[model samples]
Target: MSPALHRRLPLLATAAVLVGLYASGGLLYDGFLSGRVALNLLADNAALGLTAVGLTLVIFSGGIDLSVGAVVGFTSIFTATLVERHGVHPALAAAAALAVGGALGAGMGALIHWFRQPPFLITLAGMFLMRGGAYWISTESVGLTHPLYNRLAAYELPLGGRLGLPVTSLVLLAALALGGIIAHYTRFGRNLLALGGSESSALLMGVPLAGTRIAVYALSSLAATVAGLVLALYTGSGNPTFGLGLELDAIAVVVIGGTLLRGGRGHLLGTLLGLLVFGVIQTALTFDGRLSAQWGRIIVGALLLAFILVQRLLHERLGRRRDPIHTV
Candidate 1:
C-alpha cells in the first residue's frame, strides 16, 4: 500500500467492521434493519457516544482520563439534587454540573502538567474523589421530576413514521460535529496530535503543551457532564452509582475506533463508528433472547484484545519501516 493508504487502513477497517456487524445483525434478526432500530442505536448510546468523543480528544493529546465516568455520576447526582431539593432550574443546574466537571478536569490537568504526574494516577484520584463526592451529596438515587427534564425527555425530531431521533441524540450529533471540527481543523487539534506523537518533539516545535493538556482534559470533562445530563434525562433519576464502568466502555470504544492508546493518532468519526459497533452488539444480544446479557462483556473483551494486538503489530511494522537500518 502507498504510505497514505497504509495510514488510513485502520480507519477503513474500523468502518468496514461496523458496517459488517450491522449487516450481520440484520441477517440474524427480522426487522433488525429498520429505521427504528437505526435511530434507537443513536438514542440509546448517545451518552456513550458523547463520552467517547471527548475521550478521543484526550487520547489524541496523548493522555487518558479515567475520571470521566465518575464525573458523569457526579454531574448526574449533583444536577438532580439541585433541581429536586434546591428548587434550581434544570438548565441552571445542568450548567453548574458542567462547571464542576470542567473545574475538576482543569485541576487534574494542572496536576499532570505542573507536577509532572502520571495522567493515569491523577485521573484515578479524580475518579475516587468525584465518586466519593457524589456519595457524600446523596447516598440514594435522586428522582428528577422537573418540567424541563420531562419536556426534554418527550421531545423528538420526527424522521418519518415510527422513526424519530430523540433530543439527546441530536445533542450528541452536535457535539460530535464540533469535536470533528476541532480535531481536524483547529490549531489545538494539530498541536494535540503532535504532542501525542512525541511530547519532546512537540515542545521543541513550540506547541503549547501545558495549555493543550489542560484544555483537552477540560473538554473531556465537559463532554462527560453533557453525557451525565443525557443520562439523567434517560433515567428520570440520578444515582450516585450512575455510569459505573462507563469509563472502561468509553476507553474501549476509543480503542476499538482505531485510536492508538498511546495517543498520537485518532479520529472522532471512528469513535462514533466504534460506539455504533458497541450498540449493535448489545442490541444483537437483546434480540437473541437465549443469549445472556453477560456475554456482551466477554465479546467486547475479546474484541478489545484483538484490536490491541493489531495496534501492536502495526506499531512494530511501522517502527521497522521507519528505521530500516536499526531493524537490520
Candidate 2:
C-alpha cells in the first residue's frame, strides 16, 4: 500500500470489525433488535464512549491517563454530594465537576513536564490518591435522592410507544461533537499532534508545550467528569466503586479507534465507531445467553491483545526502527 493509504489501514480494519459485528447480530440472537439491546448499550456503554474521546486526545499526545476511571469514580461522589448538600444549580455543578477534573489533570501534566516523570507513574499515583479521596469523602454508598441529579438524569425524551431514550445519550453525543470540533479545527489540536509526533521537535519549534500539554490532560479530566455526572444521574446514586474498570474500557475503545498509543496518530470518528463495536460485543455476548459476564472481559482482553500485536507489527513494518510506539 502507498504511504497515504497505509495510514488508513487501522481504520479500515476497525470498520471491518464494526460491519462484521453488526451483520452477526442476527446470528447472535433474537433480541438483537430489541429495545433492551439499545437501552443496555446506552446505559452501560455511552459513558465509556465519552471517556474514550478524551483518551484519544491524551493518547495522541503520547501519554496515557491511568487516572480517568478514578476521576469518574471520584466525580460521581463529588457531583452527588455537592448537589445534595449545597443545592447548587445543575449547570454550575456540572461546570464545577469539569473544573475539578481539569485541575487534577493540569496538576499531573505540570508534574510530568516540570519534574520529568513518566505519565504512567504520575497517573497511577493520581489514581490511588483520587480513589482514597473518594473513600474519605463518602465511606458509604450515596443514593440519588439528590433533587438536581434526579431531574437531569431521570428526565426522558419519549421516542414513541413504550420506548424512550435517556437524556444521557444526548449528552454523550453532544460532547463527542464538541470533541471532534476541537480536535479537527483548533490550534491546540495541531499542537497536540505535533507534540505527539515529536516531543523534542515540538519543543524546539516553540509549540507552547507546557500549556498545551496541560490543556490536553484537562480535557481528559473534563471528559471523565461528564461521564461521572451522567452516570450518577442514570444510576440514581453515586458510589466510589461504580465504574471500577471503565478506564481500561475507554482506553480499549480509543485504541480500537485507530489512535496509535505512541502519539501523533488518532481519530475522533474512529473512536465513535470503536465505541459501537465494543457496545455490541457486550450486548451480543449477553444476548447469546451462554456466556457469563466475565466472558466480556476475557474476550475484550483477547481482542485488545490481538489488536496490540497487529499494531506492533504495523509499526515495525512502517514506523522507523528507533522510534517506538505503543500498540494502544
Candidate 3:
C-alpha cells in the first residue's frame, strides 16, 4: 500500500465497522433504522462525542488526559453553584467554568512539559484534584432551574414525522467540524502530529513544544467543560459524580475511531463514527430490554481490545514495510 493508503486504513476500518454495526442492528430489530433512532444516538452521546473530539487532539499530540471526566464533573458542579447559589448569569457561570477547566489543563500540561513528568501521572493527579473540588463544591446533585438551561433543554429542531435533532446534537456536530478543521487544515495540527510521531524530530523541525503541549491540554479541558454544560442541560442538574468513568469511554471512542493510542495518526470523522457505533450498541441493548446495563460495558471493552490489537498489528506491518531490509 502507498503511504497515503496506509494512513487511511484505520479510518476505513472504523467506518466499515460502524456501518456493519448499524446494518446488523437494523436487521435484528424492528423499526431500528428510523431517523429518530439515528438522531437519538447523537443526542444521547453528544457529551461523549464532544469530549472525544478534545481527547483526539491530545492523543494526536502524543498525550493522554485522565482528568477529562473529573473536569467535566467539576464544571457541572461549579457552573451550577454559580448560577443557582450565587445568582450569577448562566452565561457568566459557564464562562467561569470554562476558564477554570482551561486553567487546570494548562497547569497539568506545564507540569508534563516543563518538568518532563509523565502525562499519565500529571493527569492522574489532576483527576483527583478536580474530582475533589467537585465534592467540595457540593456533595449532592444541584438542580438547575435557570430559564436559559430550561430553554436549552427543551430546544429541538424537527426533522419531520416525529423525528427531531436536539440542540445538544448540533453542538456536538459543530464541535466535530471545528476539531476536524483544526486537525486537518492547520499548521498547529500538523505540528501536533509531528510531535506525536517523534518529540525530538518535532522540536528539531521548529514545532513549539511547550506552547503546543499547553494549548492541547487547554483545548481538551475547554471541550470537557462544554461537554459538562451539555450534560447539565440534558439532566437539568449538576452532580459531583456526573461523568463518572467517562474518561475511559472517551478514550475507547478515540481508539475505536482508529486513532493510534501512541498518537500521530487519526481523524475527527472517525471519532464521530466511533461514537455512533457505541450509541448503536447501546440502543440495540435497550431494544432488547432483557440484558443488564453492564452488558454494554462488557461489549465496549471487548471492542476496545480488538481495536487495540488491530492497531498494534497495523503499526508493526507498516514499520516492516518501510524497512529497506524487509522490502528487499
Candidate 4:
C-alpha cells in the first residue's frame, strides 16, 4: 500500500465492519433492516456523535480532553436549571451553556500552552471542576417542560412511509457533514493535523501553534455543549449525572473510527461509521433479548482492541515511509 493508503486502511476497515454488523443484524432480527431502526440508531446516539466529532479535532492536534463528558453533564443541567428554575428561555440558556463550555476549553488550552502543561493534567482538573459544578447546581434531575422543548421533542422530518428523522439525528448528520469539510478542506484543519502528527514540525512550518491549540479545545467544548443540549432534548430532562464517563465512549468511538489515538490522520466520516458500529452493537443486543448488556460491552471491547492493533500496524508502516521533514 502507498503511504497515503496505509493511513486510510483503518477507515476502510471501519466501513467494512459496519457493513458486516448491519448485514448480521438484518439476518438475525426481523426489523433490523428497516429505515426507522437505522435512523433511530442515529437519533439515539446524536449526543455521542457530537462529542466524538469534537474530540476528533482535539485528537487530530495531538491532545486529549477528559473534560468533554463533564462539560456535557454541566451544560445539560445548567441549561435545564435556567429554563426550569430561573424561567430563562431555552435558547438563551443554551447560549450561556455554550459560552461557558467554550470559555472552559479555551482556559484549559491556554494553560496547556502558556504554562507548558500537559493537556491530560489540565483537562483532568477541568473534568473534576465541571462535574463538581454540575452537582453544585443541582443534585437531582431537572425536568424541562418549556414549550420550545415540547415542540422540538415532538418534531420530526418525515422521509416516507413510517420513516422520519428526528431533530437530534438531523443535527448529528449536519454536524458530521460540516465536520468532514472542516477537517479536510480548511487551513485550520491542516494545521491541526500537522500539530498532531508532530508539533515541532508544525511550528517549523509556521503553523500558528498557540491559536490552533486554543481554538481546537474551544471547538471541542462547543461540540460537547451542543451534545449536552441534544441529550437534554432527547431525554426531556437533565441531571447532574448525565454523560458520566461519556468522554471515554467518545474516545472509543473515535479510535474505532480509525482515528489515531496518538493524533494525526483520521476522518470525521470514519467517526460516523464508528458511531454506527456502536449503535449496531447496542441495537443488536436489544434485538437479542437473551443476551445481557455486558455482552455488548464485550463485543465493543473486542472491536476497539482490533482497531487499535490495526492503527498500531499502520503507524509502524507509515513511520518507515514518512519523510523526516513532513510527519503528516
User: What TM-score, over all chains together, does every model reach?
Assistant: 0.97, 0.91, 0.97, 0.97
Evaluate all candidate structures by whole-model CA lDDT and list the values in order: 0.90, 0.82, 0.91, 0.93
Q: After superposition, how far is residue 98 of candidate 1 from its true place, in Å?
A: 1.0
**lDDT-better candidate, 1 vs 3:** 3
Tens-digit lDDT track for model 2 on 1-328? 6876677778778888888887788666776877756666766776798788888888889998988888888988877777777776767877888888889999999998888899999989988988888888897777767566667666777878777677888878788898888887898888898999899999998899999888898889888888888788778877898668788999998888777899987778888878888998988887777888888888778778877787777767776634555322
The 10-residue segment of model 4 with minimum total lDDT is 319-328
RMSD to the hidden true structure, all candidates: 1.4, 3.1, 1.8, 1.7
User: What would the TM-score be for candidate 4 when compared with the true structure?
Assistant: 0.97
lDDT of 3 by residue, 1-328 (tens): 7898887788888889889989999998999998889888998998899899999999999999999999889999999999999999999999999899999999999999999999999999999999999999999999999998988888788878887778899899899999999998999899899999889989999999999999999999999999999998888899899888999999999999999878888888889988988999999999888888999999999999988898888888887877555334
The candidate maximizing lDDT is: 4
**Residue pairs whose backbone atoms clash in candidate 2:** none
Output the better candidate (2/4) by TM-score. 4
> Would you list the rank order by lDDT, best first?
4, 3, 1, 2
1 or 3, greater by TM-score: 1
| TM-score for predicted model 3 compared with the true structure | 0.97
